[model samples]
Target: MNRVILIGHLARDPEMRYTPNGTAVTTFTLAVNRPKTKEGVEQQPDWINCVVWQKTAENCANFLRKGSKALVEGRIQTRSFDDKEGNKRYVTEVVGENVHFLSPKNQGNLFDEPFSPRPPVNINDDDLPF
Candidate 1:
């Protein structure tokens, strides 16, 4: 019941860092456009903060970039900490369980070649049952 799924473009490139214990973590902001309720109404974009850990965090940092589209499935987490000013600051972010890269493999800057469409395979007449 705490699950959340979001498909959106990266607001910026993912930032990777290591914890004090040397655990890898990555953070990124996703910009999802909301649906318009009426004709002529413009959709607003929601900026969601997302986090990934370990190998997933490394992959996200390596493959994803600004404007890259992805589907993130995760759970919401909120935590609070005291700032240097002694004020309590709270943050809410999605802790990603899985992130599906939605952009074409070739379209990513990580890849060298551009995407080329493959020709359709011809079906044999004997293969059809109907």
Candidate 2:
């Protein structure tokens, strides 16, 4: 019920850090454009917070940069904590499980080679019949 899928451009390079327990974590914002216009004017872009952990986190930090288009699949997470000023702050983020490179057309490729999307895997469950 918490799943989320997003395809957008990165607003900036990921901010990567390691937890005290030594787990790598990366956070970034994705700019998703609205498909529709408002009153004949373009709508403002939507910025979504995304996070990745461990190997995924490292890969994100290494390969992704500002303005890079991305496809991400993850689950929604929200947490709250008290800041130094004692004000409670709440943030929502997508914890990434899958990431696909989608660099922008205007900037050109960072890597010369093209990458393809993964092929779908056929599923045959015993509960389902043809």
All candidates: TM-score:
0.81, 0.77
Per-residue C-alpha lDDT of model 1 across residues 14-69, encoded as one tens digit per residue: 99999999999999999998988679696789999999999999999999999999
Candidate 1 shows a clash count of 0
Over the stretch 3-97, how does candidate 2's per-residue lDDT look in tens digits?
98999999998899999999999999999987776567778899999999999899889888888889999999999999999999999888899
Q: What is the lDDT of candidate 1?
A: 0.92
* Span of ten consecutive residues with least summed lDDT in model 1: 109-118
Off by over 4 Å in 1: 109-130
Q: Which stretches of candidate 2 lie above 4 Å from their native place? A: 38-40, 104-130
Task: Give the Cα error of residue 95 in candidate 2, in Å.
Answer: 1.2
lDDT of 1 at 84: 100
Clashing residue pairs in candidate 1 (N, C-alpha, C atoms within 3 angstroms): none
